[model samples]
Every structure is written in C-alpha cells, then in structure tokens.
Target: MELITTVIALGGVARCTSLYAAGFSKYRIALAVAAGELVRVRRVWVATPDADPFLVAAARDGVVLTCVTQARRLGLWVLSDPVPHVAAKPHAGGIRVTKAHVHWAAPLLPRHPNALVDPMENVLALVAACVPFEQALAVWESALRRHTVERGALERLPLGGRARRLLTLANPFADSGLESFVLPRLRWLDLPIVPQAWIAGHRVDFLIGQRLVLQIDGGHHVGAQREADIAHDAELMLLGYHVIRVGYRDVVENWPRVQDLIQRAVAQGLHLAR
Candidate 1:
C-alpha cells in the first residue's frame, strides 16, 4: 500500500524521485540514517554502507531517486575535475538532486548481447533537457528513420509533455505569433468542427458550436478581398450562420477579449440551437 509520487522540478521542467523512509518499521532507523546520508552526499552507490534497503528498492522500481547516495550507487559518472555539480536543495517534502549524467544501464540498456547500442533514450533525454521541445522532436523524428520510435511512442515516456507540446505548437493552424499562448488555452476548449461541405467551398478559420464561424483576418484577408469578405459574410448570414471576424490585432494584442468574445458567441449559438 505504498503511495509514491514523482517529484517534478520547481518549474515542472524535470522529474525526481523523493525517498520516504518512515513506514518500514523493520528498517525505520536505518532508513532515516540513510536518508540523512543521502541528503548530505547528493549521490551514492546503492552498495554504499549507508544505503538503505527501502531506498534501494525504490530505485529498482524506477522511482525517481535524487539523493547522492542513490546516484553514486546507480553508476552515474562523477567528474574527476573540479567543476561543481549543480545541486537543488531539499524542500518541504524531499531532497532534490540534478543528475549530472544519466546512466543508460538499467532499463534503457540494450538486452541482446550482440545488439548495437541504443543511445535513443539518453540522446532524447539530453535533447529534451537542453533544447526547446520542437527542436528536440525534430531530432527525434529524424532519428526515428534509422530506429523504431514512432510519433506517438515518445509521449509515453517521462518527457512526454515536452514532446506533446512541441507537436501541438507545430500545427499549421497554430498562430505563429500566438502559438505558445494559444496552444495551452486551446486544450480547454472543445475543438472547432470542420465543415464537411465547406472545406473546399470556403476557408473558415474556426467553427464554434454549429452556427458561428470565427475568421482570423490576417494581412492576407485585406486589399482586393475586403469586398469579397463583406460579400462572404452576407452569404453566411443568409445561410443562417453568424460570422465573427477576429483581426490579427485582436488575436495578438487583446487575446483575452477575443477569448471572451468567442466564449459568449458559443453560448449564444448553443442557446439558439436549443
């Protein structure tokens, strides 16, 4: 009945394992002593004299272990030179440790004796940590050509959030200027429907509910097409549809108001439909 939670770094950028040594009565005091030593050392080999059985079990189970005692025992390489290892201090619940380098040994290690070495996880993790998600995914996608990782496979890993966000931002519909801001909010809204007949008939930016269409009027929507836009709106109105035009200014400078407008329009459309 042990409950475990993976500790994410302060900004939700990385995951760490928090060790809890309180419950195992058989090894309570030993566990407490080991925890203390782990906090001080920042990295430890599992075989270290101060290593606790509970902590060792947790690491074996793939729980995010961060203390030095666990790090050293896991075969993480320590630099011989004097560059300091970056350390995150223990807070309210558990001590946080930034791993200097990930060991490809345990689960990520290749199983077949004659198999070529698989550096995918290590490379992906390093790329995920260093670069923005999109660049990392690009690297991953390219690497997939020679390897077996699929588009959806990476989402099951610990770094899935990074991959998911990157892919979502790359959507053609995502606004280049507002891509980062809008993608997170888009998850809260129901996806706009794509009209079956209108896909080729006319390009609508977004169809909210069933009757209201939101058109993002970019710079391209101006000039000779201005009259055409007016004609199009008239035609949509004749077809019992409400067209709401959002200019680039509204989307870029006053997005909250734009969201409010869309929310209200959807509510009105729902009421009319009912």
Candidate 2:
C-alpha cells in the first residue's frame, strides 16, 4: 500500500531507479508486480492501473510527448491533431511510434531519462518549429494567458528567427485562439485592433479602429451566452458601433470572407467615428 501511494505520488508512474532511490527495494517491487499491485511498462518502468496512457506510451516507446500533443495536454489552445506527437533524440534508434508525428530536432532542454513529458519550454519550442505560424502563435499566446510560460523567460532563450518573431507578436490577452488567429491576419489593415476591449460594460473580441467591433463566438457561445452576446451587440449598435459577429468556422474555415467584410466596412468608413 505504501509503495502504491509512492507511485501515485510520482504521477501514478515511476521508473524502477526512482522507486529504488525512494527506498523501495527491487525485491519488494518484484513481489508487488507479481501480486498485480503494479504493472510493468517495457522493462524499467512501473505504473498504476489508472496511470495516464500517454505517459505510459511515452515510457514504453522511449519518447517524450511534445509539440501539439503536449500543448493540448498542457491545456493550451491547439488545432486538432488526429495523431500523437512525440520527440526522440536525433540519433536515438529503435524508436517505434505508430502514425505519430515524431520530432527529431534536438531538445531545447535536456530530457531526464525518466521523464515521460517534455518540459514546458521545450514543448513551446517544438510547437513553434512543428506547427504553422498562426497555429503556433495561438499556442504561445494561450500559454502566456494561462501563465504557463513567461514572455521574458522565453525571449531570453536561444530561439530561432521564426520563434523570435512569434514571441514579439504574442500577447496574453486573447480570450480564445480565434482572437489570436484574427489579429495577425488583419494587422495588415494597420488599424487599431484592440482585443478583449470593453464596450458598454461588456468585453468584445476585437474592436477594430474606432467603431467597428468584431465579436468571435467560441464553442461556449450557446443558449443564454448567445442571447447575452446578441444583446451586447444591440447595445453596441445603439452606441454607434458597427458590430460583425463570427464563429469558429467563420474564422477558421472562411477567413477570406470575414476579411473582405471587414475591408468593405473599412472602405465605407464604417470604422470611423461619426
């Protein structure tokens, strides 16, 4: 029971070396394994029955979960990926991963031998390198908003040019990934696109220029939330704000249409205060 508690404290999985160093003898561990109190992963790892399957897979496959896989696991905003993303040493051989995107670039931080998940900093670096610019920026800004990684610490790292550019643009104020996606695409308009801007006692997604307001509806915008947002739009319109509302699909699937709408609004001077 004590051994099981120890393993659970170590995140329901632990290396034999860690177990040994924690004062559990190999003989006792073997006895526990025999009695089904612990399950062996590959050779040197042990896990509780309820251990995270991803970590167990990482341990068995000799890889660290990284990139979008790790980003999702860390509760950062990331586009859906059907396959797991894992990282292995550039020269490390005999790795077997099925239908997974395996990142072979050198780690931003040295991975511990017993680590199943990549460090947060390393995960961000891998994300910057692995995903597209907008997607990667969303992840980075999500991390910033969640306080998972600090901007200053990231800025001081030996980041590549692409990553450095992303670091410069990443802000901690996006209420959703959609805002992150919209800002960079429309920055070319050279208008003031303020995110999470308060208007008439409510925060809007993006307040473009002086009067054009863009409200992006996430998955949570349903039923009562939808009604409230609509009411807010009515209120903004009453106050002389031109409101344009969109959803996940509007931003992700049909961005050009959305952009055209914004551009036309700008061309008509709708964004100008009357």
Candidate 3:
C-alpha cells in the first residue's frame, strides 16, 4: 500500500495501478483483490459488483481505477488489454492514390500575402530537403499554378529571363512601376509639341520625318498657346511643312483616326522627298 501510493503519485492515474499489481504484487489473487477494491473508491463510477471482492474492496477505499471500458467510451486511452482483441478490416476501394507532403522555408513564403503556394516553393524546399532538381521543376510549376498565380509570383521565384518576360507581358498592369506601364512604346512619336518650335524655335510633341510635324493639343494648349499654334501652323505651311494637329482626346480615344492621318502625312512627305 505504501509502495502503491508512491507509484500513483509518480505515474499518474493510468500507470500507477498497473505498475503496482504487475511488478510488486505479481498476479496473486489476494493482492489483486485488495488493490482492485482500493481502486474502486478512487473511481466509484467505474466500480462494479461483479468484479473480484478484493478489487471491489480497493475501489470502496478510493484507489484510482483505469478501466478499458470507460477509456474506449471516452476515446482518451490507448493501452493494450490482456483479453482477446479483434482488429478492424480494411476498406476495399477501387483504387487509392497518395501524395507526399511538401515543406517550405520561412523566407520563401509567398511575398504577396494573397498569393497561393506554388511549385517553385515546393521544388526549392524539396531540393533543400535533399530531393532532385531536374525534371522536378516542371512538375513543381504545374502544381504551383494550380495553387497560385505562378507568373505573378516571379519576383520571389527562381525564374529565367524568358519566363520573366512572359510573366511581365501577361498582365502589364500588375506592376505599377514606370518601366512597366508608363513608358512610351515608340519614342519619337509620343512626345508633346512645345512653343519653342513655333516662333522662338518652339518644340512640338512629335516631328514625323522632315516634312510632317504633329502637335497633340491638351487643356494647357488653349488660350495663348492656341493663338500661337494657329499663327505657327501658317508659318510652317509657308516653310513647306505639313503641320497636322490633333487634340489629346483624339490621340487617346480616337487613336485609329490619328494613326491614319499620320500615315497619310508620311506618304505625302515620302512623295515630296522623291
């Protein structure tokens, strides 16, 4: 009983009784009866009259009991019982597919909090964790796109030049940088016209060939600039140059008409040049 108290304190409620009865007292009926009775008092809810008298007596005295029946009902215990045990049969399915788990490093976590996990991260982590890196890149790319916008995750991905270019042109608006969206596609055709090309050597927005000078009029080009522009167009005509002027709205909204005008001016210039 003194040894049992020590075991109970060290081994918690579950292991104490088993250790005492099995190691110290052996399988003797008298010891089992005495221990069992003490165990019932500690766990009255688990005590039963059909149990051994000695065990019953131990229960009445309040010794902690570890019952398999109670544990099974609560799903809290997992100890093997000496009684006969039957194993559950496995389910017969048509086919079973299994996939391996992938782990990623902390730094490689998606930069875009909204972005999904991708194959680039998977392949990187796998390689770091000792997996091969050859054909695994393609496999990872496929898996990554399914989970995330792989092209959008290029800043953090180990992508090459061509892949980066493809990603860049995919959604040009995704990046707000000047290089991506604001920069003009054609240099000489996109600049605005200035007053210097008018009288005191005002510079216009664009000069197309030697004979055609184009002006894109915006709100700022009204009032004084508009008067100057009318005067300048006459002088430019006298100088043997065709001045084709258009508004910002025409350039932005009616681009096709503006392009046609420029093309006609270019053809006229080519003919005059010859």
Candidate 4:
C-alpha cells in the first residue's frame, strides 16, 4: 500500500529505483511489476498504465514539463498551441527534443532528479519568456485565480519588465483568462466593475455599476450549460439587470465591437439601476 501511495502521489509515474528509497523492497517492486501493476519505461523508470502519456514521455526524454504545456496540464487557460513545452537544466546537454519546445532556462526553484511535472514557479517563469505578453498575462492571471501561485510570491522574484507588469495586473478575483483580459481592457471605464457578482440568484462574470452584467462564454459552454445560461439571462433581465453575454472569442478577437456596445450602454445610463 505504501508503494502504491508513493506512485499515486508522484502522479502515477516515478523512476524504478525511486521506490527503494521510499522503503519498498526491490523484490516487492519486482513482484508488482510482474503482476502488471506498473509498466517500466526503461531499466530506470516505472509508471502505472494510466499515468498521463505526456508526463511519461517527458520522463522518458529527460525533461520537466514547462511553459504553456505545463500550464494547460495544471488546468490554466492558455492560447491553443499544439507543441509541448519541456525544460532542461542549463548545463545539461544531450537532450533530444525534436518533438517538444525545449526551454533551457534555469529554474527559479530547485527541481528534483525525477521531476516529470515542473514546480508552478518554474512553469510561470518559462511562460513569461515563451508566450506573447497578452497570452502570458492570461495564464498568469489564471494561475492567480486558482491560487496555484501567489501574486506576492511571484512579485518577490527577479522577474523581467513584462512579467512584473503582468503580476501587477493579475487579480486573484478574476475567474478566468477571459475575465482577466476583459477586466484590464475595461479599466479605462471609470465605473465599478465587480467580478463574480451575485445577482438574481446567479454569480455573473462581471457586474459593471449596479445593473450591467457581462458573461463570457468559454469554449466548453455547450448543451446543458448553454441552456442554463439562457435561463439565467432571462431571470437577470426580469430582475432589471442588463445582460451582455458574449463568446470568449469576442473578448479576444472582436474587442472593438464589444467595447463600442459597452460604451453605448454606459452612455445611455444603462449601467445604473434607475
């Protein structure tokens, strides 16, 4: 049970010799292996068959998952990019990364010898260097929203100019990257914009002033969720809330139009409860 707990805690993958140090006898490990409880990556690594393939691959190729790939694995929202990102130690050469985006930047925190997943600190640092400013900010804000990393902790690091600015804008209150992007863009508006505002028995994505409620539908907003949102929008309207529901794309791609609509609403005094 100790061996199983150790492997599960390690995200279902670890070096074959790792179990020995955790007090599992070599004979016990061999017995488990023979019983099909673990699959050996080589002579040195072992993983449960259900372990994440990406993590197992990173382990096999000797790199720590980093940047957007790691961010996505941690459930942070990032711009879609197919290429996997991995990191190696600064001085460690002989890495074959024909299949991944390899980052050779030295980690901010110490990494372990068998690190398949990266520390959140390293993941954000690599993301700051690898992605564009807006996208990186989104991921950073998402991490802050999830409390995966604290803004104060990241602020204390020797971050570059762009990263420092992003940290300043990151609000742990924002629910998603879409919310993060929308909040900063609308900062030029001199009205109170509250996120996750409860009104008409639903928590809106944002409530501008007292009546204007904004909702950004993410990619996964479909079927049952779509029906539920529609129902809530009607309820909000009955309660005199101005609902502005838009797709996540509108916030990212067609922002000027959204901005214009919002401006008009504010001009018409629709944001205020009269």
Using lDDT as the measure, name the better of candidate 1 and candidate 2. Answer: 2
CA displacement after TM-score superposition, residue 6 of candidate 2 (Å) = 1.1
Q: After superposition, which runs of candidate 2 have C-alpha atoms over 4 Å from their true positions?
A: none
Compute the lDDT for candidate 2: 0.91
How many angstroms is residue 194 displaced in model 3 relative to the true structure, after the best TM-score fit?
Answer: 13
TM-score of each: 0.38, 0.97, 0.30, 0.82
Candidate 4, 55-104: lDDT as tens digits = 78887888889899989988998887689999998979778878789888
| Model 1 C-alpha lDDT per residue in residues 137-157, reported as the tens digit of each score | 444443443343444655566
Among the numbered candidates, top lDDT falls to 2
Candidate 3, after superposition: displacement of residue 86 in Å?
Answer: 62
- Residues forming the 10-long window of minimal summed lDDT in candidate 3: 174-183
Per-candidate alpha-carbon RMSD to the true structure:
18.0, 1.1, 25.8, 3.2
Encode model 2's per-residue lDDT on 68-130: one tens digit a residue.
Answer: 999999899997768999999998999989989999998878999888899889999988988
Find the candidate with the highest TM-score and give its number.
2
Give me the displacement of residue 81 in model 3, in angstroms. 73
**In model 2, what lDDT does residue 57 have?**
91
Window of ten residues with lowest summed lDDT in model 2: 107-116
User: What TM-score does structure 2 among the candidates reach?
Assistant: 0.97
